[model samples]
Target: MIRHLVLFKLNDGVRRDDPRVVEGVAAFRALGDLIPELRFWECEWNISDRPVAYDFAINSAVEDTDALKRYLEHPAHTAGVALWREFATWVIADYPF
Candidate 1:
């Protein structure tokens, strides 16, 4: 099993109301249904005065590191990358469970 966690900070001028942000968030939430290897998915919006912003986590109970690697290169994920590029910062962590 593996847990993949990520946090994101939008670029200066980007807000929660942005359509791109909304779409990206919805896409991430649908990963468990869209990707077989994604066993669980959850996300949180951070309404704080810190650099760390929204957070997303994925738990893969049936996938190995290789599967995670494939997920990162998957089309859905590629779309996320393209959309998230406008964000200012991103933090990610992956660990075996």
Candidate 2:
């Protein structure tokens, strides 16, 4: 299996409640149902108050590298990324388990 992890930091002055952010979050939340390649999915706002913490996270898994590629190129995933592009920056890591 491969784990696909993402951490997001909201752009300067962008609040979680912003209409765009709200929509982006919803889009990501629905991805598990939309993408068949995902074997696991967990997304949420960060609870930490530490200065270095990211604002949001996505922890997901797929069967392997090919499945991970499919997930990355899926329409729903691409759409969600487009929405987030306006409001956040993120980092991702993928590894086999």
Best by lDDT: 2
Clashing pairs in 1: none
lDDT tens per residue, model 1, 1-97: 7788777777778887788888877777666677776766666676566554453333344367887887887888777777777653687888887
- TM-score for each candidate, following the candidate numbering: 0.79, 0.99
* lDDT of the structure predicted as candidate 2: 0.98
1-97 per-residue lDDT for model 2 (tens digits):
9999999999999999999999999999999999999999999999998999999999999999999999999999999999999999999999999
Give me the runs in candidate 2 sitting further than 4 Å from their true place.
Answer: none
Error of 2 at 96 (Å): 0.6
- Model 2: residue 10 alpha-carbon error in angstroms: 0.1
